[model samples]
Target: MVKQQQGAGHSAEASALGFYYQAFFALLTLMRQDTDNAAVGIEQLDDVDLKVDGHNLLYQLKHSTSDAPPVISLKSKALWKTVKVWVDILPDLTLSETTLHLVTVAKLGLDSPLIALTNLEAERTELVEAMVEEAQRVLDARAAASKMGKALPHADRVDGCSAFLSLTDTERLNLMRRTVIQPGSAAVGAIEDNVAGHLKLLPPEQRPAVAMRLVEWWDRQIIYSLCGKRERVIARGELQHQISAIVSDIEHDKLVPDFEIASPPRDYQPDGMLARQIQLVDGKTSDFSKAIREEWKAREQRSKWLNGSPAMAVTINDYDLVLEEHWSDRHSQMVEECAELDQKGKCQSGLEIMRWTHENAPSTVRPIAQGWGAAYYIRGSYQVLAIDLKVGWHSDYAKLLGDAE
Candidate 1:
């Protein structure tokens, strides 16, 4: 009994490994079937596991940790059912291009009765008769004993068995010709590695985002499988759109960044290259030094004006506008303009920036606002690497000048 139990465990493990190989094959199939101009998606399903270009490809992947038995033949219950289904669906002219494949990690079953046939077309009638005979033999032995009822539905048993027996010689030949038998197991890991290489072949700028999108796509595939949703194929383009939509939704609902200000202000330094150039080109008492001093003094005066009132902090109501202004214009000019406004008390609150942002903010610019914080500041020198709105504004504007209240 213990020996028998051990054998069963080994069998179960092999079965799991085979299932894993099948899934990997499906993923690799999707990668192969994906095209830039067309959309396609893959789902775990029946004999036809992949659907593309309006043609269905039935992928029958079989794998084993060790070599399978010698002479593995296509004479099993699986083969018969596949044959029956294709026969029943033969009348559907739209599905004429559907192809059947028998992929296995094991050698062909040489001893199986179907192995002797040399010419499938010439011996088509004989082949059908033999297949029907084999099917009935299994049904008589297994179905009557109720041992394989779950696998062989009682309702479709007569219909399917009859269909296979009735298929003409030409029909049998067609089915036989369409069938593809790959008897050797493929390198599973190589499949994924090849896919990774393909992804890397994409444009360098797009590779990173596309890689992330593939991850999201894989995750969604797992979730869908877990939910028992079977065999739903989609265009790759459509899948990409779905993944992007998911990312957008996640950003909108869950990725809202927080803004907080510290009282003493954060320690920072000016752009090192600019400072070094200034030190090397202009002495401390030179005109450059005087200009630097004036810029510092202006920044100091503006900071005081903004942070002056113990009762209030300067606020920019139009963060988007302020962000846009800083991005589109020179930082020094923006600082000068803001300083002039502060002198007039118009810059007491960020209401102007906020108002401007509200009026001009486009959907394209909304993603940049995700990183804004209470510590936002502008510097004439390279004190802080600010977001340049001219290009893709990858940086966020710190909104530190005022309290949220």
Candidate 2:
């Protein structure tokens, strides 16, 4: 075995990085249906050890010689510096359009008070699980939000978002009773309010359509994301994050961010993209993050029914999605990649993403929508990525349901 050297615990650090590489590979396999983007290629960017799709991931594997676990920090400041420096330089080496990220894998997984691979206590596993879930929460939400606004005539956007957000908070204590979401409860409340306010403002003409679009998007795009949210909860085991202002539409056509009254401190730096990603990681956690997404969709659905035609309003909140600030890194990555393949340059929008997910994803991913064809959508997370989606009703009701379902 390689011994620990004086150079920033390179041995242990590299081992942790290796584990991240494996996990990420598995995640990509699940993410990429055709295995193209999933074919990650690593290159030495000035010998600093840059991963192909290894940004904003979190994780720490552990092994003990005799007693318990390791500490959070792996080694010396130089080691931490190595990571920080790589993060700073990665942007320069990344694909001009793709967002580069810094994935800091913690080697503090084993022998600690909580969380373990084998005989670890449930509390420990849950604690570590909490951290992992928080990060995933960020990734999922970010992906959705990055594709909002420019949505087509989806029917479920508002309702799904509304219900999911509401349910998330209502059950936070239960989901994270063994973790730290309590301290951030106030933040959860703020997010719910923010989502509610924005969803309420969806174009009065298109509420139900958007709500349904939210649910459909989730089924297709996120159902088997980079890291499936199945039973296991492990970090990138890393967290995908981004910083976003919970802006509101006032008298003017301005999207004014509302951080002064939220849990996240308004002083967060937003100049650089990386800084924003980190900020989002802290803001949109899983405990409340997933719930918020579902709520936004639901809200859109409700809006459609309340304001528009009653029965004809057409509820589709079952498929819409909101941007998770925390997981914005992966979220942004996927959206942009899909946007590029959208084939229709500059046509990226809510409708576009919805159309793509519905048309491309397996039948299980299809969402409920009204009208005859696909929909167009804009960024639901950040202000950049957008895409398309297929829509309408099928003639063969029984066969279509069986096949689709």
Candidate 3:
């Protein structure tokens, strides 16, 4: 039993270290995306995994080597600790910009329904219930242990207990929502792949040498500190400094001037079709610009339909009419279906209409609609009829698409 526990401990430690390495690269990739002067660190005294500019993001990364997926429960010790950390930081000014994110390489535990929660109201209720339960559990356990002269499993029980009790319902909900879950191995894979792009973004002339240097520098300075081999504690700020130093040296010795870096030319529009289409429709770019400015001025009046009944359903046919006029596939089955639906007066009504659209609409439209979180189709004919049939439909469609809620 003792040997097995020790082996398990080693495995967990190794898994955590692997996640940190990936997370470090992920943070680095995000940091290099812009010219913003920011600081990022790991295992900082602030209980934050990454801090950039004024915003702090805390990530609790989890992975399982077993066939079964790793699970994180709201009632778990790990979650309570995370909550405690946020509570401790709440009074600090960074609290406004700080966010707590949970990144895991597996699905959440079955007991945690918070994963499926989407409605803001429902999420708030659940978070409040969970927070209250966890606070009671921890405080009770700590009190019992103290009375028995026994040591509890968690440290900082005194401060954590106080902070947990002190947090209001609104504060708890805000913190809970900020605790985003990045599920599955896909999240880690995305980070690793994106880091490759960041590496490619390095000056083309010194790319290979600079890439090799970064790898060596990270291995020498960062990896040891992360894995707990180094005796003295190294804050993330120190790690950031070391990285900047290495990159600076490489640039000074082997790279060209910052001004010489190739950049996309101004007004270097990529879409020839859009440019020509706008010119043909509005007669000039100035008219196109004026149209956009006028639309911004009357956005509220134009979006009145969105404020109507949530039950009001917008069918694929309605979306097609609004969106497919300029579509390329004029004679496709999708175009035929749109024509058929328009003749049948098939505004959003039931599953049959949904099934028809799902089956017949172009492969592209259905997914885009589904991404807008349309579980069932609603009749949006009223909205379609009210809007300017020629040009305003496009703006209305854009507005509806933006209203993901």
Candidate 4:
């Protein structure tokens, strides 16, 4: 039982690794495409594949973990299954323009009949004939086995071979001419290196980091498209634009404000330290809600920055100190001007301070990153400070909260 469970666990791990390989290969394909308008889709039109520049380019990716590469023989299930998919969809494709690719980490032996398919100069008619002959042989063997009352497994492979032989000579020739067998393709790790190589616009030290970020973004985009959360295709131009933006941010030493649309949980309540600080200024329920959201965004962005790099962490700390000093100066001035006023008047002054902080503080205090102009970041950072009791909107907030020390 334990052995069985261990085998299952190993199988599951290999399956997941294969999926990651497919996704990374898709990223490599998108990076290598010549046309900017070409779009890529995963598990859509093909496995780890899609259309490029109005021409269908379907790919079947096969990943292997063996020390010695597997051979893709004529009767290989991977080869036949790939052919089956193309045959089933042949009617919907423009045979003249559509290209089918069987990309695998496996190797094709020198004497394998499928090796001819990889040669563009190979005679299409001869290749088609060879494939048809192989398909017929498989069917004939299956028939002989059935006559002996013996059942052969892999019905899917048999069905695929039969379907290939059922096509007309001309159709088979066309499909053979369009098909390409790319065996011994790069493994998962090599493919990642290839992806990083394409990021020549980025510095050598930054290429891996940028490539990782690009692939992560691509994975999310693929998931969103697959889940119907967005369009089903990701254009090459979109990918190029993303790369350019990431490079620009790195070059300019600017941080990307990635949490603009981030929010707190749906059931989030305004009852924290930040909320109480707002309430001390007689803030409304709406103000409390907005403050909570701003604080959440700020904290999330800060966490991301801290995880990004030591430089980013230092930048955040410096920015926070600047904010604290700015708020202290403003708070001192507000307290002096409203010191002679009644308690009700002081409350009104506190409300005015809160309004100014929200409306004008961002403009006065520049963002830590030069290119980032998101005003909400500044407002949210103030809320974060308020939450930590470092800053507050009310003139006597420290005394009111019993934290004057």
Highest lDDT, which number? 4
Query: What TM-score, to 2 decimals, does candidate 3 have?
Result: 0.41
- Superposition error at 288 for model 1 (Å): 61
lDDT of 1 by residue, 344-363 (tens): 33332232332222233332
Ranking of predictions according to TM-score? 4, 3, 1, 2
Q: Which ranges in model 1 have alpha carbons more than 4 Å from their true place?
A: 1-20, 34-48, 67-71, 84-93, 109-163, 166-170, 187-190, 197-216, 225-231, 238-405
lDDT of 4 by residue, 1-405 (tens): 001111223586677767777777778888888887788777876785567767888888877766565588877777777788889988788877788888878788888778887875677776677778878888888888889999975575787798898889888888888888888877766876788899876679989877877876777787687789998878888999988877777777677777775678898664377767877778888777777787778888888777777567778888999989888888899999999998788888887777776788889987777678877788888887777778877788887875632
lDDT of 3 by residue, 291-367 (tens): 23322322322243244323323532465464344232422433345454542232221122222222333343543
Worst 10 residues of 2 by lDDT: 180-189
**For every model shown, what is its TM-score relative to the native structure?**
0.41, 0.17, 0.41, 0.68
Clashing pairs in 4: none
For model 3, name the residue pairs that clash. Answer: 313-378, 313-379, 314-378
Global lDDT of each model? 0.44, 0.29, 0.44, 0.77
